[model samples]
Target: MRRLPMSLLRVLWVATAMFASGSALAASCAWPDWDHFRQNTVSADGRVIDASTPEQVTVSEGQAYALFFALVANDRATFDRLLNWTQNNLAQGDLTQHLPAWHWGRREAKPGDTTPSWGVLDSNPASDADIWIAYTLLEAGRLWHERSYTALGTVLARSIVAKETAMLPGLGRTVLPGPVGFHPQDDAWRLNPSYVPLQVMHHLASALPEQPEWKAMLDSSAKLVTGTAPHGYSPDWVIYRSGKGFGPDEATKAESAYNAIRVYLWAGMLAADAPGRAAALDAFRPLADFVAAHGFPPERVDTQTGTPGSNAGNAGFSVAVAPYLAALGRSDLAQAQVQRSRSLATQSPLGYYSQVLVLFGLGYLDGLYRFDADGAVVPAWTSTCPAPR
Candidate 1:
């Protein structure tokens, strides 16, 4: 465990004291970006809302990211608030017992109902969100010295191993995107590269040595990233058959877009000694090169032909690749992308997805936090600075 600095201790108090008023977080200097997100995207009740949708949907992905960001900010009050709301509303009041539903928001009442209701819009749970939430809880527990958080995280991780994974014909155990609907045929199982972050897998293995499944997944997840991105560009979705191995998913036409973007982000933030770091960096070099040649990233790429589409990516895409470029020692390009991202943000307000990407990309570039060799979170706020010269 690390000691919190006096400056950050003040920020924590500000965060907790303003729990009812929801005002002080905006004024904290620990992380200005986090302050903006806490004020804008997260609701007073702790739900992270994608305000663009008609239903104003609340995805488990958003909630999970918020938990992580709060932890990085050393704002335990917000983290617990977010966790409590997720358990009570999305997980049927017991996150350890049930995987939180991936989708929740305003819902129109069924036939004979008096008015539209707000509840679980979809019962299916997203595995990415589950993994992130479990990881966040485990880290929070260790950092805060809270046994309850650790116990809950352990159960959630075990539940994930039990319910969200499947044994492939030759690949051993691999994580599915969700519990259902991914296996469309007898031989085929659909998977998302973004869903299996190797860094996260590494931490899980170290943290839960008893769960051998986490250890095996390190290779399987690495294969998913390298195998699917045959042209050095990851696809949003891919399929693995009993004998055929990895193939493009027709459902998504094998496009590399929003979902695939995350994978590069995950790989970029990997610790130098983390498993599969070298291969992951090499496999996705083409995307980074494209950004280097051009000023921005491609909005879409044909994963098969290595051909980038005509449209350029949004501000989020540019910023999201900052870590990737920095990882490759392209400091010049990294700074350029971050500058472009900020300029774009000034032109127009960023939406939820762009907002989160900026947080992840900019946060890492700014030294707010990093993942260690053991896959544990190393937030900047946890440690004090050196004595002034």
Candidate 2:
């Protein structure tokens, strides 16, 4: 009789083992399915990261956006590899240095004179990087449930704002490399209007509403860029000392126009009062109408006639229009525009800009359908763009 009880125990143990094995097997098979999903939606062929092209330093800004896409897509393997590669290869990838200068293509920093000064990195430590890194780290923390990642995001965001305010005339004393006698208006300290990380602040405000600074930053930024300034009414212009400023040219304006639409959308949703919401929408109308009338803006505008300064395709710039159009109750327009933009993006040789367009297009398209209404975009979808084919 005692032996019979032991036999029953053994049978139960075996059954439990079999169940566990089967469950593990199911999980093991999940990758190919995920790859299949990515292939059909994100990538035409789902095996590589970034369409298997090398990252270009001069165009590192696009690369950073792609990194975020990878993180959001829940491709942990690729994400980890990218992080490792960035750390080893890029100057800003050095997470240990909270304020490293963002180097463009090559992983290592090099001595040189470049015009962009902030093509990828503005002011040594740029607001664009701050905003992007903050959101990326925040998303990473949420996905993995790790406090460290969130902490990194929080610190980076705080640092970004601090850096910006410090650079305000007599406030910020720090200076970066460039030519001697180079003025603040020069490449070294020249404020890249497009580099203002207002969207990050917008996102942070919602994520941590308790922090009043986030909202304050957003309000102040809106005023500074679009609000009545001492110089004149500007729409997100680059501010310099001596009260000199340059409005977003065609290229910068195109980027800002799309960004502005998104920021307003976010602000309207998070607004505590009708006046605040109304103001945001009112501010967006002119910008939206301008874009609708003219195609996605040219790279640089003459700043006088709002005419294209150079005859060039906006490259990845057009991808942003899709989501904004969709948000404004123009779904059909958004889809058509996305298709046009994606077709243009695909024509690029290296697939760097084109892949980003594909990802953004997918996200915008998926988002429009998910929300079905602008007011409900938040809970409707989070940004997990399909991988590039």
Candidate 3:
């Protein structure tokens, strides 16, 4: 049965490859920095979202690669364009084997390519890319009422979640395969245990709650992530199946802060609504505090010495702190964190992560929803956990 599905998926991939050929189009606008971007495009508030003309810029193949900007700036038009582009381009590949990794340029690049590669499926699927793209596509579908995107997005999310989890052998977090699995660059035969999927699962649960299986997956994911952490310092990398810990790797450890922050913050947020919210929140608090003090996290930590080791820069990590702070109801702290992150990001020229942080920070600052000064949820999105009226 698995083989049959894979074969069918492969055929679909080949068929889609026909249209996948091409370099990326330019972004319609010139968002040199967050400030300039905000001035020209986004209003201080949430109601007025603007997009730079497509003539101004072109997005890459990956859903999130460009969609990040769209989401942060709250530019529905550009976001829609990028999402459509992802559905049309990246989502064309094999449903079973090598999924669509997004391409960054006119020529869709895969991981390890000189240029920024399409984040779509690479030789093998990277869990983060798969989940992020799926999440974004679903959001796009909901925002735009695009049935095709919604359907495809749901399929993508399900396919990746099922395929990857099935390959694993026990009750554990879904780790990115080290060898020919998801990200081959890191460990050849290990699981790149990451926190990104937790976020993905949360979104999935909310997006597709009717499906008992989806809910089960989310429950499984929450258990695995929150359960596996040692004092909430969830090691960035874990050897596959064997359950051995592998710290961060060279490919993108500097971004550890960026990724880890999501795990902690999302875990904390979800715990407030999860049935086992108390324990999860307890675990996340320590990790969050550690990050706040360290300023950075390593891809691989010296377990013996408890020291940090990572290869990426401060850009990714810095940008992540703001949201985490805000989520914890420390808006003042969140703003402070955002300022520091923005400063570090600015020093690194133009990168997607920093741009995203600035835009999202601005969004939070603008009081997009009904968040208070402390970033508390006065009456935000309702959780499965009941809130007092």
Candidate 4:
């Protein structure tokens, strides 16, 4: 047992210190849950399948969400795979030229086909999913310094404005659910409040200032979210008449259910300094109070009557409302919801949609990312790994 030379000892010490620093850096940037989500829900070819259905359909929404989660996790490989699969399978091989079809996967093609076929089930584009994809690509471009991502995001954003939005008589320019079917009548158009998250619009406006419609969309969305929910709850869909303004969509019976739940989640996740933060919170205050009183969100609510169905919201709902509750300064209530979410996640695993809500809500609450005043993403990575000059 001989003592090492002084120079050798100093070199070993430096190497050990460097190793520790590198390990810490890696840990700080890791997002293991996202990896788990990819393993469980996404396929090798990048299709995100919702296994709850027997048909195992892959939706544009699923792909969009995976892309966002991948970006957040800083997994460029997964991000590229997800984007490529979406463009090839859903958007006819080019995202810039085509809005990805909403639904694709296995389904019976004809009345008597023995073997089910795999392809695009519906050619319609869901604006919500489209926005998320575009936002992720744009932010990825900025964060990762990838010109290709930025270019694709710019084209997709412009395409969304062109195809998915329309000029409502009194509402100004508004985002329709898609390019078609939303406007069943000449003077009336259907809109989904959940389809346009204010934060996403803000990001788009900041990313694409030349596109005036993005700012108009932000203004109109704030009006719609606050004006439509007279009873402090958002409806899944609503109709706007040329002169009448906002009203419940007859088809949905004014129910605030799955789609509407995201309204509170998005409102809560907004940066404290984000534009219209105060008004958006004020508009959604009743929901915060409801969760505080009830210990969980209602599975369904009558938007006109403020009456909630008996069933309690699942873990996903608890997670979605947690950020909103915290935003309203009810940290205790928010913590309660967080605990409830943990318990629920333990009892039953989250499905695709619930997982998305949890990721958005809890990620913000955990300080993973924040939207700036202008709506661009401020990811944790910026602090960990600054861009090159």
Candidate 5:
């Protein structure tokens, strides 16, 4: 065989190298769904509003999740906007001194007030959102090499521990649903199992090892997540008795609804080898089984009776459960969920909650990022792109 000219070989080699580099960059930097979400759901000031309704309210949860998405996309500008908005509007301009309020929106004009006022509707801070916000900030600091982000995250995490966690009789350090109203009585506390994502707890622990409560909270979080789902479906809220442990909360009628849907999503998004992955997946197996058998999730389920309501869960449910199914090696069922999510997204515009769920579950399945065993974010860009100059 005749050899190619040296000049031609060099050109081919350079072209191949460029193509490989471009492919890696594309894999790392590509996030079309995030672009859509930013354009449709997020405001210029970085508030993630629920446009499905007329209120145009912003929740701390929305802001927190958006911050995480922005971090994964490596969009520092958007992340900063979100943080600044949260601090200024929700936390009274000082995150270090106060937990951000959970709700902010326009209110009706009061006596002597002509124009409607827009501000914090509820000053009560949601611990779930608080934790997620801290996690994102910490990860951003590490990934972006910004000390300010890390310091802010550390302060937020410390505040969460101080105000939102309790040392339960049997459960050790447990996370409360919010700063108030969760403690209904002296002997009991209301807790949302879905409020504490294990990965978030783990990440915080890894980041702030000095705070022993973070590690202890991880153990309690695992127990809370698994023990509450006795029949393999998580409850929206549960009450922790001083000595008896978890039981369904009276307020929610033992129904597993929208809030509990995230339990499966969190489990599904765990690194395949992450700690508690097996037990977590096993605990929520019934949800996976239900989706596999019914072709969709139930809109609501009686956790005590295991009777599913007539209404089917939306595309968000399918999307949220997809990663868990995939993690369980049920690729076929997982793919079905993805297709259902796509079909639902095309049928009509997804609301804020559904859109967030889809972004998280599908984003994980698509290799956008992964939470390491220690709960640190490992975005694809880590391997594809060099550090910022």
Candidate 6:
């Protein structure tokens, strides 16, 4: 080929270099929330620690969430590490055989022993965490082409159905908080709304179409969510007694607080075409109105009385409600919440639950991830660049 003019050659070289830099930047996109969480929350060995607790606890919920954030960020090595830690420490060395224990922490010193031990603090499994872990694994399998993960996830999901679910008199198939303690009486079954995220339930159902119970659970979850929040505010816990229907949980006195906040977040992040999306949004509209009028969500609300708590919710609460407000067509209010959350984030660090809320709400709003109508995760990395090898 004939040599180009010197100036033309120089221009072409600069354009090519810039294009390469842009491509690299796109390929290595950073999610600031995920980065912060990984740095502050996750250990080198993949344990997600909450140092504030006496046990220096590692909750199954934290591990499950880290697995999800890892997949979203396309950090496969980190995902594997987290999963290994969960399987070895929480699941008794095999997730396929045992649901991960809910808590791993320091044991209290015995009467004669000078030191305490560190191990599974509570062997009872948390169903919500189990569901999240299974859901994330299934999605990771699809998104990353990991058939092992898909197999492991399938086993766990089936195990959850067999162990953690009960067919109530009115509800077809409902997830208990765990394998035990939820069914205190023959006639009564206590349930938690936060534990019944429809998106994850639908995703399980969609991923495992051969399992009929997943579909039934999805429909029952909708009924549970919509039915329990009769006054537009979800309670942290409710008791469903045969013939009596849903009632206030004596443990919580029917207050909507920390756990119930996730109910709003889950409902808000649901795809537009999700089943029962309309009823869920309408059932929870008062929350949007409350935030709009008060400039902040209440720290607590009485589901039965429709009373707001005196104090504003925590910093994470601001971001947690952003998606809900936006879904309700209150973009102005949503923007306000987003600004508040960011401002608080600059001031100080929040607790684990708050941080998780911030991640879910802001990450979804910022287009880092989304859920499809059938509940498959749509992490931005999948389309923004090629999958990380």
Model 2 TM-score (2 dp): 0.59
Top candidate by lDDT:
1
Q: At residue 319, what lDDT does model 2 achieve?
A: 56
**lDDT per residue, candidate 2, 13-46, as tens digits?**
8767544422211211122323432453232222
The regions of model 3 sitting more than 4 angstroms off are: 1-62, 68-74, 87-98, 102-122, 172-189, 192-199, 209-212, 240-261, 268-281, 284-305, 309-315, 329-332, 345-350, 357-366, 369-389
lDDT tens readout by residue for model 5, 1-389? 99999999997887675444332333346788898999888889889999776567999999999999988887777888999999999999999999999999988678999788899888999999999999998888887777888899999999999999988898899899887898899889998888988888888887898788999999999998999987889999999998788888889999999999999889888887789989999997888888888899898999988889999889899998888899899999999989998998899989899999988987788877888888888876766543321
Q: Please provide, for model 4 over 3-102, each residue's C-alpha lDDT reduced to its tens digit, 9 standing for 90 to 100.
A: 9999999978876754433222332355555667889889998999999887799999989988987877667778899999999999999898999999
Candidate 5, overall lDDT?
0.87
Alpha carbon lDDT of each predicted model? 0.88, 0.44, 0.46, 0.85, 0.87, 0.87
Q: What TM-score do all the candidates reach, one by one? A: 0.91, 0.59, 0.59, 0.90, 0.91, 0.91
RMSD of candidates 1 onward, in order: 5.7, 9.0, 14.2, 5.6, 6.3, 5.6
**Which ranges in model 1 have alpha carbons more than 4 Å from their true place?**
1-29, 109-115, 385-389
- In candidate 5, which residue pairs get closer than 3 Å at backbone N, Cα or C atoms, i.e. clash? none
lDDT of 1 by residue, 1-389 (tens): 99999999997887786653323323222678888999999988899999999999999999999999998887878998899999999999999899999999999768998887899999999999999999999998887677888899999999999999999988889999999899999999999999988888889888998889998877788889888888899999999999889998898889999999999899899998886789999998998889989999999999988999999999999989889889988999999999999999999999999999999998888887899978898877566422211
lDDT of model 2, residue 156: 58
Error of 4 at 201 (Å): 0.6
lDDT-superior candidate, 2 or 5: 5
